[model samples]
Target: MGDSIGFNVFSFFFLFFLTDIAGVSPAIAGTISLIAVLWDAITDPIIGFISDNLRSKYGRRRPMMIVSSVPYAVCTFLSKEIRNLFYPRNCLRI
Candidate 1:
């Protein structure tokens, strides 16, 4: 749910923000967005397959959820941190 919302927000605002505010070229911004979208589309089905077939004691959903949370949180954090690191002047204090 949250991820879908984030993706929607990213698709809507992030290209403008990247090009206008962060000084990224439109081509680069588009590439970044395309890569993210493509990566999600590819990995989701693969992860779904792995999850459905897993025989863990904690069951498929719980184990996959736990395993995936680390990357989710890290990516969320790094998104902000990378912006701040490179474009501190443009970064808001959120």
Candidate 2:
């Protein structure tokens, strides 16, 4: 699905962003990514259930998408621009 693509692309770019530009160690970057994977794994099914059994007028996925649009747009734009705009050394490095 389209939603899944967004996550996959973000993860692909984000790992490089963390390790290369952010100066995080490879180990730390992998751990951070693993944490995200675990969280996604845990939340996806619960959210799916909630959306499936929801009583909203818009129903199911639409309402979630509508609510998530703002954050998603902000994050997507920010992620796309991060590699060019900033590279803070000794800031987030481990």
Candidate 3:
């Protein structure tokens, strides 16, 4: 649930950041976002396979989830902050 919520929030804000704040054209922004979605589609199953095969005392997903949480949160926060700071207001006009 948390992961889904985070992804939703990031997806909403990231599109605005690209189109409005970063002054990217809507078409290009859409293309870039499409590429990211495609990459996720390609990588997710491979990552799942690798993690499924991982053997450890802490178990496969648990250790990776724990290790990833901090970095993921930090990166998400920093990325949003950097974008906000760099573009105080929306730069692109419709």
Candidates 1 and 2 compared by lDDT, better number: 1
Tell me the tens digit of each residue's lDDT in model 2 across 19-62.
78677999999999899889999999999898889887786788
* Residue runs of model 2 more than 4 Å from their true location after superposition: 1-6, 84-94
- lDDT (C-alpha, whole model) for all candidates: 0.83, 0.80, 0.83
**Local error of candidate 1 at residue 23 (angstroms):** 2.0
Clashes of each: 0, 0, 0
Candidate RMSDs in Å, in order, are 2.8, 4.7, 3.5
- Global lDDT for candidate 3? 0.83
Per-model TM-score on C-alpha atoms: 0.73, 0.73, 0.76
Lowest summed lDDT over 10 consecutive residues: which window, candidate 2?
85-94
Q: Tens digits of per-residue lDDT for model 3 on 34-56?
A: 99999999999998997999888
Clashing pairs in 1: none
Off by over 4 Å in 1: 1-3, 88-94
Selected candidate, larger TM-score, 1 vs 3: 3
